[model samples]
Target: MPRPTSRWIAERASVGTSTVRRPDRTTWIVLGRAGADVAVVFLDAEDVELGRRTVGADSWATWAAEIEAGEAVRWVWNDTPRWYAELLAAGTRLARCHDLRLCHAILRDSALVRADADLRVHTDWDATPHADPPAAAPTLFELGAAPDAATGLPEFLDDAVREFARQRTAIDGSTDPGRLRLLTAAESAGALVAVELRAAGLPWDPQAHDRILRGVLGPRPAAGGTPMKLEDAGRRVRAALGDPSANLDSQPKLLRSLHRAGVLVESTSRWELAQYRHPVIEPLLEYKKLSRLLSANGWAWLDEWVHDGRFRPVYVPGGVVTGRWASSGGGALQLPRQLRGAVHADPGWCLVIADVAQLEPRVLAAMSGDRALADAARGKDLYAGIVDTGAVATRAEAKIAMLGAMYGATTGDSGRLVPRLRRTFPRAMALVDDAAREGENGGVVSTWLGRSCPAPSAGWHAAQSLASAVEASGGDETRARRWARDRGRFTRNFVVQGTAAEWALAWMADLRGRLAALDAVPDSDAAPRSGAVFSTRPHLAFFLHDEVVVHAPRERAEAAALAVREAAASAARLLFGDFPIDFPLDLRIAESAQDD
Candidate 1:
């Protein structure tokens, strides 16, 4: 809990502290806080207790770093950021780890777990990382101490040991232990990559960002007033409405003004607004775009998030229920193409920008083993391949139909084209269709790699029961049906999306290792702006759902690119294992992360 340091040790090492020896294979160093000292429990690769050493708080990092330098060690800890952040700051890198919190989250909800596994009872492990963990200093499980305030997870040696044992038992006893093990490994690796991505921040050019803002929104405002371009757009909208005093920013007032002007839209949403053929539509849309830019990533945002030419956003891996990465700040995932020019690299260094082409659909192809779909996705442009299948008339129609099939679209062109897709690619269609049915029936569905969807809530069961009652009203039945349909769409996409996330994690983990093995550049040529651990070497600077941006020295750019490609191939093999589906990358090595 306290960064796995020496402070938890009961006593300091003597003047002649000897070197701690380990076996030839991997060792799991379990750490926790106990009173004034750090509790350390070392276990072998088979989970047998090899030895235990309690070091003073001051000597913990040094000891751990020494162990890390030695050979083949995997640190088993309750949380990654809590323990590894300090070591990383001290220029210590961990090659592999079993992150308990992340792995627990995966294993607890896994459909492969037996219904009576002891892991189901550890509700404390269900907590998000460091969400009001026990505040008191944790003691060794042998000491019978309380839970850690920081992690809420069992912090004592006995508790940690028991938890680890339980996890192993669950994994060993699962219906598909291999898939569960792969999911856990990938999830834990993702945890490490998330921290590293934050530490080695994304390269950002504030000057370029400012230039784009000024060009699009007109120069920054003098005080609190709107920019000239935004004001101009608003003026055009007011004039089009024939009411100079109309309040364009207020939804209610704008709606009334639209009604008065015969636009007659129910709401001011962009989609609804596009349906109307009014002069105000264009300017109103422009106004909305500028306003979003001004608020989300405008000048103020640049000052707060971008510093020293790097933008570090907090990445929450497994943040979405479907396992997509989510950003707590800096809008990392929603970066607009217009502003990608701002993602400039350090001098003498370049970014290897690579993203899988059609990641989810290809994942679907592999998991369902639809040879037709896999053949269609054998190369670039999966949608175009679908067109060749004669499922739809054009690539655009193919795109819509595939999306509809995954997302449960019931109306529009997407819905109409879905049936054609079902006929053409029945296996792939049946996979999602079955997931949807299970979700609607309140049965849990799992990803290809065993990440299960959250079970339906009590409210859901109640609604369904009420809908089935003899006294139920029409409104009740309609509401229940809508809820079920909404849930169906979620589970329908979960299998594909979650498996894609697993693939991404594997890709990044492999790439992280490869990049670390690359030769480090001289200090004079180093990008110190990337921070201490990664500044001297080719390290991963950024990662989104299906994409990664690696900052490498000019000379190592090609090697890094090759590493990215090789990692993708390895990840495919690791997950799908000889499946014909190929994950092609739209890769580029550029001085900036701008789209080509």
Candidate 2:
């Protein structure tokens, strides 16, 4: 097992697992299918069954709302979209949940768990979440039968109870149960947020989107015809190449054309093409840029994604191996900056747009307990602070050096400048170095919150073993060394990047609750297009990796901004308690997200 490297984790371990305790009033309600009705099993903090009840399909939503209104409870369910989507559409918003699928994935593979943990046993809980798109309307009762095997996850009452028990046992018996507990909670909360984000879709302006596309692409092309600007750029590129009939879209043909034109480039990639001073470079780059926009977020995309004044993207929680969320559809993660103007607030609403500055490095400083790095990142620009420390002569160098140190860059200017950072911030450098060494030796490494990277593949072990044998050839050694270094680079960055993702999740989860607590506006002032539960309230509208946009009534915009800042502070404290690191945001309040 990989040792815990975080000071906060060590401190938490010292304080014992009592820190995992929940509020006294909180109940754990497990819900699953019981024939045509919904089976509900209530448990207290001690994992003892408090009671059980079965509600008919017709009254499930109403009964759930009543139970939610009564006291603090965290619902445990098979899947978030399967259960929560209908609730939100029926105007029921949950405070918290334990998504068995998401949590099982976390605890089962966590490095902190015992190797013999029962949760590690192969089961249906290991199945991925179902792929069906969330229903737009309330269908809790109408969609009657329980999910079949095709849905991926099991939905029987017995399955939920057994899986929940196994997860609790794994956490309770883990080497660092507190950290695993926190990770599971955050992961489950992310599942809830994913569904809610779809429910309260991002406010979008289709007219503004079309206008931006027109301004950039020079008008939407008719079917089977290219836009004017794209066509002109293509014409310029072909003219520069002196091959009027050149096929710019075909890489092989384009390369051959470039070679014939004395461009002598090996490939058509923009970077390789830029190294030469050919007249074709500028227009070729421009053509590729415009072409990407045309295909990615073009007129076709606008017609498909945006509907009823909202863009609802499917968010897949824990979609990345690093525990980061990924978009399953609608290209939410790749929304281009050119279309920012299209993310418009409603008539009576404003957007609180905020994103962290230098988030990953700040996380690295705090997690590694490098007080010098933390002091530099306390309340201002982290790279500028590195410059003040004399680690590098310029802020640009400081940025490059810090990134190189974290990413294991070993060549060029980044490689040359990284030594200065190592000398100045040895503690921070040591953490990644140790992780790299571990990976090079075929060991697993974990993040601050205990999400472990996958172990080395069998091929990796075979190559390493073969290279160590007596009759190993020069070629075998070379390939083995190269693979080791690649794995080292991956593991070196995984700890920092994965922890940074956890911090971001903590930030969003806390902010989600704070925004929910704000007073709702009058129904007349509501942005009714936002959907049933979110129409009258301030809610999260959009989220990238390190940024969030909150759609709020103009009256609550300031409060929402404050909540955004407060949430950053809270997330830092949650991950690295009492550590002097800060996550500063470049925040703005505007009617259009483009203003920021």
Candidate 3:
């Protein structure tokens, strides 16, 4: 059996074989850096069932000290249960490492495991129901009991997905992706993920669902704990929606619970607080602190998330590249590993954080078969190295300009800078420019893998054609000339952005698959199981931009770090097999959310 991602993670981190991969892994391990205090074990996706345990009740610090004293340990990788996750269509199978033993049982009844089952399903997210003309009041019809989803959705796929991702990347590169639509998607998905988690018998953030309902359902009145009639609340909803002056009486329990959990804050009678924080909101104070760091030092604010004991980040599917994902809501991509001070050891615990560096760009170079570009990046930063090869002035400037060029960043410093970069690096610039031009023309793009960017609409085509005609007339003064500029900009960047997104999706999928074989456990606490010490699954709890957070224990923490790195390495291998590009990662360990 090709081992799963977690087992792969453990084996690579320590100089040992894992049972999941090599039968050699089943043999007793020779002592290594992680020491005896930690060991490899197994658990369900939620980490609720018992499998195996390694350490005694001693604090993690005590075990670390013992490892320093020379002993080898093999415990299961255990962390918190993501029992609450459910709303996702693809489900957790895409992001987490699973035991074939466990997955076989879990998926026994699931459609995914059924040999005859089809994988595609369609929603009206991209349907042109509104194509006829914008209606003042769009028809509100019941969409109960979804029909079998549309097949060959690639036919229906539009440029929205890739365009959005590129816009996001450019925006992410320039500024924080503060409280955008994706945040809503992530939070909503998280709420559903929470539901599934609860079904798995883990701690469900009831407070989260309650917040969702309260937002949809107006506030409640001050009454006893008796259940309020839905009719009572319905009346309140009518009153709130109709009356201009009447204050919305939110469900005190849900609203107050969110307030207590730090998930929400009340800004005024009309609105509840969001994680993004706005002026006049409670989350604003925290938001401002992060914004200041991002604006001034860029990524310096990541230390703030290191507090609260463990890094619990959320993972979004299709969050980035064409089939990619984004992680701003949970700070998945933006971690401050060098500042392990943010993570703590509890009184006797320790923190371990590590990552694979040069991931996406390296994947790009390898995928594109640009040996010259890959060779230039063989032993140094790709951008910095690119600057050295044929760029002028600072390496940072070259990198910025190149990235900006690839993503259709125009009219700014990156815009001004990209032309110079193009002049110096013709081949590299030509590739990105070609991709960008495809998007502008409403054409589809693809990743090294077969993932395709969506196409444009008929209206979009008409708009572009009109713009082209005006430009062709050589009359910059015409109104049509002015209109075409907008179309030109959109088309210019679409393909490149879309293709980049496609690459991201494949990278995540490949990484998830490879890491599953590793059995990367954490060194955290364990809840009991039947005669066995089933450790908690190292659940992802938060995500931002490109970083992921795993709430792990000391025993499994190092393994988790190994998983993060190997998964990335595997992603590179999966995309380009073997190339001249090198992707390196940085590492850090911490004990709390406030690591700084």
Candidate 4:
């Protein structure tokens, strides 16, 4: 790659004829492919083009590092994994980014944005990130091409600039620009974190994982064979059912076997099975548990996912409609607690594990501005605080009532306890109740940061319309009411859950920066398995909704723990801004993420 000569820079500067801002004044750096070269467009705070440069693929990382080192600028790109993955492989870690694809999605459907906003128009900018197989270090040039049908997002330089402008316009013209801007930034930051998490994978101890599996399932069996303990449980269940030929793995077969034995359960679900006073129940449950372990994170899973001491699960940021992340593979989101001990730190490092307590309820308190609920949640367990408020007799009841309120549960113990909560915390209860009503009426509800719940589907409208027909049948009305209530429950939780997701993003984003700021350990003590960009520093290892695990050198473990706690506080402040609500974490600094 040839270096950009002074004459080449001057010519490019003159071609644009835009007043070049000082390096310090550059606020955004947009990157995109330009033919065989990469176009780097610098923008000012107002999104005005400050200057531009076209660098070859061979020199892209070097140029990016130079420009990044010169000033604090947020890199604007189409997709994070496509661009940032290559940079990280080249040992170039960026502080921040503006992912156009992600921001476009948030702004386009956001209830806060005007209906007629240009961003609302269907465009390729609304495309999701490509679902490509995980590569160790994908090259920028190899990933760059014209917008393909696989991922509708545009790939060239001009496309990114136009999309960025549109996003800015949408946010600027939104009803609450401040909140929308924050949401977009937080969402984009989450995109970067997602890639980093995959690149700097969670450390794993394969031997420990094998041990846990053996202890639970009793030895790895031959290919296509069941484990010893699982087979034993199946035998015991079969014996109890008096059917030696019964296939415990088949739910239909198992149900028939149970009915033949007079267990008489409609389904083989654990809850239903537990209702019977039968000898098969215990062994059946045991079989199911072992089967889940084998299927989910068993020997096969360990062999496939854990590589070179790291478990690199592909994280799909903003995958859920409510802005919660979803894993495409490797079951990162569903890591079993029993196997958490396998999440081992490096020989010279420690894991700073932290997860927020009662995140959704606390978010409800803050978003609703429910001072009474906030007071109850101030510096103590939110449920215990509710107990103190006399909302319920015990902490367990307090939790049940709060969950019932948010989830729109209207039966059983939840139904009994919910009314007490409605009276005690009217503001919080009213907020969710209002959302439920809107959802039932086919309306949309937005999170505190403006991520809107998806509108009712066409099928929903058809059902609702059928129920309201002049000659509607009783079943039609019943089904419609049930569907409406189901939607109501979904939307009731959407606001709190979505907002909680935003808070988690803010927490992780803040924590990402803080961890980056910590001093790097000596090379001899570095955790090279965390990848080249993160080996020497305290980098985020794993993130699951409200929890985060940071792999840090022993020397920086305390600092990383402090960063985790401080980030939670920062996230709460960023979202609620002095709402007097707290997000306390259950934090532990240890060598392995083993449950106590």
Point to the candidate with the largest lDDT: 4
**lDDT for residue 283 in candidate 1, whole number 0-100:** 97
lDDT of each: 0.84, 0.85, 0.38, 0.86
Expressed as tens digits, the lDDT of each residue in 511-581 for candidate 3 is 33333344533434542210011134443333322444444455656666676666556645544566655
> Residues 132-152, candidate 2, lDDT per residue (tens digit)?
435334322223445545332
Please give the TM-score that candidate 1 achieves against the real structure.
0.91
What TM-score would every model get versus the actual structure?
0.91, 0.91, 0.46, 0.93
lDDT of 4 by residue, 93-199 (tens): 88889988888888888899989988677476666565443453433333466653433323556567778898888888889999998998899999889889989
lDDT of 2: 0.85
The regions of model 3 sitting more than 4 angstroms off are 1-315, 319-321, 326-360, 410-416, 465-541, 592-596
lDDT ranking, high to low: 4, 2, 1, 3
For model 3 the local lDDT of residue 198 reads 23
Task: Please state the error at residue 316 of candidate 2 in Å.
Answer: 1.1
Model 4 lDDT at residue 288? 93
